[model samples]
Target: MRLYFFSGLTTSCNTLKFDSLKLHNETSNHVTSNNITDESYWYYKNSVDGLWRRWDISVNSETNVAAWKMKWLNQEPKNILGVIVYLTSVRELPQLNISLLSLRQNLFKPRPIVIFHEGDFNNVNVQLALATTLGTNIPISFEHIRFPTKISIKSKIGDLRLGYNHMCKFFAIMLPYHPLISSTFTFYLRLDYHSYLLGPPLTYDLFDHMQINQFQYAFLMVSTDELKFVRELWVLFQEFLNDSCIKPSSAVKKTQITAATGLYSQAVVFNNFEVSNGSLWRNEPRIHAWLRKVDNAQGIYMYRWGDAPIRTLAVTQFLDDNQVVKFRDIGYFHRREYTCSSRMHSCSIPSYHRLASHIVYREGCHP
Candidate 1:
């Protein structure tokens, strides 16, 4: 087993050991090939009985599209371009307005905005106010999140008070398959209501940059999640890999296996400021199947599993290192974590806020 040292503390992977004996015993019945040396084959052979079984969840294209009620405030953009998505509620309207203002000021060009809300957004005045803030040139759409009866009924976890868990599932699993996004946009950027872009105007369109560079995923910051939320997640992911006969890329396998030895406390992409290629999730069959498996596990509600870690797993498992890019020129702030280019004079947050060990700094910035 490999050892990982973090912050002057040495931790062994064996600290959170998997039940090897149990796994061996469970797979003893399967015939092994004398010359087969592939570890993924063994993982497939050792699949536990009911851990990653298929569920009745309807995650197909048609069913996913029917799950939301979408309305456009203005005519849809005639040309298909990238989109900016915000999953917000009425309580966050003030912050949402500020976020839009920042986007208008910093973004190089006007892109469409799609706002997702849980309940009815029938208030005409509120819609008008949001449209006015976004400016008339930007296409705006409001989508009402209609939780599927099948998925909601299966969420047995009792912590339904704030609906945060629902948000996790929506962003992690459902957003990519939404009809408006899947059919139109080449890429999508997720910026939470509290997230802000705080620097000089972007020198180029971010979406065009991603497409030109052939980047599938991009992020501004990286951080770790609390252990409690992801305790069983790694094991479940392993089971899914084994049962589904999916071999992760070499980089993913190396890092995830090492991190799993601990408790997955290594770096996770801070998804609130994430930009992704829409086709990666929408067109990939293996990714779609993996998403269904995760959704069926009900961990979103059971343990308050956030989308950042979940997306991190997906990125590592399915995408290559070259496909992922780290943004340096854009200054960003969300919650208490922030990162900015050294040349950014207009960044509102102090430089000290970006000192956390987990935050990824631009090339020359010192922590």
Candidate 2:
């Protein structure tokens, strides 16, 4: 029965009035106008494996993708694990050198999880009976070569490390690509992030009564958010501390390095800004239409950005400067003429936009 409570004046002492149940030690948090830490803390501590699973099925021969819900789990918390890889483009398997699963994650390291699909998409009216059957087990693992940042799904021959997000520092296990095909083949995916506490090795197997007591109380407090609703809960927490008799709790918790700045906030801001201002979808209004979550899936939690789904998912840019790749006629995708070379990460995304009057990926795929 771990319990945690807080208010405007809650201190370190009474914070443990019920510390006997805590699994860790005292936690101190504060708010800042542009604060990213609080949200980061929540992401690393709770958002991993946080959303409820929604099962969706499809048939036929088309491509569909989804980014579903992600939230916190009051119960067991753990980090997220996923993988994405392109199976085949032809109706049958090609004689490739190695299975996508066997491919080395990067030139130097090995990826943990692996996923692979069999077959290709030649029969449009055809059910991907065999291919999809193999897809269910594909664990999401991005090639490690995409270091510092970058995650790409599908070994389909391009460097795709960029992911999308509409961040307010709030994250959940989001299944971004929900593949469905009824005459349509779709992609199904899940997103999540969790603490490193429940990780491998020597963890919280200690004997601390006071910390346990505090955790017993905090655990009962629903979410750190709910505690804020009650008036003077912080004050009560402080009063408990003034007693001096109460000892501090010792509860172990784990969070991502980003937790200090806000879980993926900076990254989200960077990626979204790239997408919002770049070309990822076909049409703005059409993209908005696609943004609506169906079947009460995971990602949709009440609209933000504009409260107008139309605007938030609106298409901003449609230029691909890399190699010319197109998602149907929606638009084209290409690498930027001027991107961060191994030697220089000089040009920012916006700056990349500046190099060429318009992206010329339709112009080519490599330098």
Candidate 3:
């Protein structure tokens, strides 16, 4: 089996190929691995002695600039617009099936789907079930991801679990740098395991919509982050602004500052149902610097700083209002938060459920 490692230094973002590892199947309780036995694999392992050490030290060094590089494989994708990605596990397979079914039924056109897991579905039964669910027509690929480990020794904030912090970092930092994803899709939409489309079938291809409009990012909803998790995040952000001298846009200035206290607001872009241009996150130099700064601070592992607020701050600080868009006319639901289009009757959720302080509604939708 081939093992791939991404260098922590931005200057050496090329793929580090280690091809001699062996694949192994484990019992249901153990996380499977393609190259667990290889001693060289320690360099890429998710531990203090592995990639985390390199990631921590390199990002903090002023001489090292961290960036994601695109490395294409031999088999190139053909005319692909975008990919629908789900970071899921064995326990979430049932919900994943439902989500994929919803995409098949509701999307105007089928897009390739990628399922990422932490080496839990290395068996035949799980593979067969996924193939059966999406069927033979749509292109689907399963990729194994390393389990996320603690980057800081500080105590974690709140009651968030390790997996939750992993999800936040994965979406925020790791996903775009993925080799296949970067080489294949122009954009990607991230859907949580519990997220579902509950509207009349999408009338347009979302990828085309963004491409034609030159939009860099789109989100289904906007909400506020918990103050406890993000209390120091703004301070860190302010420090970045001071050091980098990047002026905040009018959109950011208007939304983030409170009227009475003149302090940072807790507003964030809900990213559970987010569609983003791949290059915006992958190729942008300033964005890479900002991400490196945050990672070095250990904000993700220590304070439970979520990708939603991190990306929210990035979009506001770096992008103009025109580059970012709010997606309406698509009924969507995830966890307790949901949005229903007034023009669509396919929403299964009750109308009263639509009213929430965090959700921002537009078009035919009302509070």
Candidate 4:
């Protein structure tokens, strides 16, 4: 799957490593040959002797002077992950140091590591001229959120090409009786909004741009340039409350998700095929199995889908709760909320995405 992170180093991502089990983008430097098993390429294995590794990259016409290069040499835990920067000028290298060393963090979580950019760096004089000329836009990206803390995310709200920054409400397709007392339609709308932002910019000739205008207004109270537009948009949307956002007494709208832990020892097939954690043997082999693979969790969404038969996450991160501070950064998003009632015990909030979709939740059947 393919996804675009709204935040993170501006560089396109390629791999998600975990002890010999690696995922690398097809176009990345380390994955070009398409011979993942060849194991004899230049970019094959730079990581430790055992820990999983994957490297990725592709060609682009992005930089010339003061550019940045990533040399993640798979060194010791915290030995060598530094930016080899090409700045426009050394006159203010000290200022750029903040951008240079932001990646050198000591946090237990993976904070957003990055390098700021400007003009030519190799030449001290040119570097200074470029920095001053493009001072305002130098940082490239900023964070309304932090990372590697209680939160598991990092991102850069780059130019519009990254994705649209807007608000979307999550609607309870099942619960229409009490709209306000259910999971806010925020998440569902968000995926649509992502389609907008990540798709491409719209070009209109004004007179016939009424549709665009209404669309923009629906997302933001007032619109200006991209940056200011999102600020206004955020406030306008937050007011509408949902069962998850504001916990209050109200006519219940939707089912809740209950968390149960245990073990599974058997399997049953709709037809004659087996579906286990390891085999994602396309839904047709059996039936729909998309949502089934997503472990239940709040604030979840899918990021990428592509030719590799694997997944590539572009922007798979969401705010944790009210603060909009801590968030869960993942390739796809899902959440499970426990609901208690007058039943024998408790049940989890139920959600269905396309009908007849294969339903697979972690549990053991009663003997």
Candidate 5:
């Protein structure tokens, strides 16, 4: 089975460092028998041949595409489940390409990757170049989803003006339904372009655990008490639910939103669940309308309204907190912040040595 790995990045010297990690590792076009050991992690295969499969089916005739999908479906693995969904804007395409290159060299198996972007057809060509240059064997596809530059959500902090980065990240929630994304993929992994997987190849068994629990989303749990980010998130989330005609969870209703800065007070984390998709239809339109309403509104524009809180809240609307697991063992690193331990060290690439030092010596809030 050949799985395609996709990325959302571009070709630039400034961002070439991101793909430098690929240089340290060998690039193989096929997985030999020796490489497929008991511990080897395998990804879904793409029986549908050709680079044309990389583009969204919406661009082609629906009847023709449907016939192709039906044929592909027959060859899909029985255990074929989810995909790693990566998002990036046109400008960040170069960086994402670097990430994909590194992923190609590091992992034991290739993953079915969908690069959900906020760009035009030209950007898709750039991604294709990077994928080919990286010499990845997996099937890769790109989907261009329009993101709003302006939004209407009222923020207590100040005027909220979201950029491409913010919109692309949050827009991932809808990628599972995109025409380019196959229904065979039940879970979608939303990772940052800068986030590098250093160690412990994620096995399919772990995905089975995730799928069994009905988790639609997952994230690395970070401290939000200091900034009162989660509290504000709850208040805003409640308003979002009300506007969307969905009911807010009890954890959201009972939580108190206080104006407290960094102090000794411990924050409340909402760990609550029931599985429901009643509000899925309101996902895109509500966010779009709200952004349009607030994009040009007058207020302070010093600080930006981040997507983390909103994204976290969005997952809650679909699944309970128990379904959204926080995995620290993934050995993730974004910038200087990382999850580095003795176990992770064994499987990590050479770059971990330099990056690990910065994390251990530097004083930064790593959540």
Candidate 6:
């Protein structure tokens, strides 16, 4: 397996001490020889040294910025398919600007951007103009998705009307039912309007790995010990999957993830395998109809279920951990929490990315 690192950094962001990993497209100082690693790499290792300690980037005598661009940024991968975002409120416009700008300036090649928002296109256009000024040149299309007026979630607190942001998660899942995506497609990367790409744009190779592994979904796994709601959310997630007629798979069990402790947070990548043909996400009417029932059903609000953990649980029903990959090097920050190692940050160019601090509740993930 080849170990790919991100580049472009002036210094370490936050406490991340290492800075040699940054991939600078303009300078060859970060470029290393292709005579790197030839061994298979497993993402999850229980070593205190962290994967960064083992990363070996050999310095070469001469720099080839053009070749470096060709290898990492010049060509776009076909497997990316498309990128989607669900923006529910106008308040998110500011965050949208930052996210889109980072994407436009950093993404290797332009990919289709589909924005689903309830706000008027006028404001969206304004934001787009700002993003363009920031560097967005990719083709973007927008669709108006109405926010659900009522919440079926019956809470002991009262008739719960989960905010529009929470509702956005449901709309996000509606992708499999959409006309453009097909059962045989490769993969589609989904991002919340607030989530931005901080490393080199993802490529077809990662998607191909997911396809070969038969992964239906991929997400960033959160340490259950760090989240208070993991147990309750997992219980409700299991209930939803059970009601939806999803089956448990051993792959999920291999990770020692229980109904009470599994959690995959932030950016989701859906593969065409089970997601396209299986009963879970692929079952549009059946699952959505079931969701309506659950939404209205009472007693579930005790856990205050969230879409991130819920979707993570749902995927476990049909696929195993083997099919899924929890990325730590992508260098992402939600509100503030950073998942990448110091070496990973070394790859990030600060002008194009921000250092993440402690992770906070994503817009709709918490009360």
Q: What is the C-alpha lDDT of each candidate?
A: 0.63, 0.20, 0.64, 0.18, 0.40, 0.40
> Which tens-of-lDDT digit does each residue in 1-367 have in candidate 2?
1111111111233333432322232232212122222221221111223222221111111133233222211211122221222222232232121222122211112212212221122232222332232243322221110111222223222332222222221111111222111111121111111100111111121112212322110000010122212223223222332443432221100111134653211111112111111112211222212333211221222211211122111211111112111111111111222222222223233322243453232211121
For model 3, residues 1-367, the per-residue Cα lDDT tens digits are: 0111100111111342212211122111222243454321111222112222112212212222222222112222344778788888989877778777778777877677777776676565776677667666566666655653433346466555767877888888767655434545778999988777876788888888888888888877776788988868999988876666565556566667777897888878788988998767645655766777887787887888899888888877767556767776787777666777656653566343344443434431223
lDDT tens string, model 1, 246-359? Answer: 655554545445554643444567789888987677555556666777877878877677888788788877765567777777887776666776466435564433444434
Top candidate by TM-score: 3
Q: Per-residue lDDT for 195-285 in model 5, tens only? A: 5665565543445556676544444434344353333334444454554555544333322223354222222221111112212312334
Off by over 4 Å in 6: 1-80, 127-137, 151-153, 157-161, 168-175, 180-186, 200-214, 225-248, 251-280, 283-303, 341-367
Model 4: CA > 4 A from native: 1-92, 97-119, 123-317, 322-367
Candidates sorted by TM-score, descending order? Answer: 3, 1, 6, 5, 2, 4
Model 4, span 1-367: residue lDDT tens? 0111211221212441122222222232323332244332112221123121222112111112122122221121131111111211345444343322221221122211211122223344543443343333232111010011122322223232111111100111111101111111111111110010100112321112212222110110000122322222222112212211432111111101112422111111110000011111111111111111221211221221110111101011111112111111111111221112222132332232123332222221111
- The C-alpha local distance difference test score for the whole of candidate 5 amounts to 0.40
lDDT value for candidate 3?
A: 0.64
Q: Looking at candidate 1, what is the lDDT of residue 312? A: 79
Cα misplacement distance, residue 305 of candidate 2 (Å) = 4.9
Shift of residue 109 alpha carbon in model 3, Å: 0.4
After TM-score superposition, what is the CA distance of residue 36 in candidate 1 from its true location, in Å? 53
Of 1 and 3, the candidate ahead on lDDT is 3
Report the lDDT of model 6 for residue 125: 59
Residue 342: error of model 1 in Å? 4.7
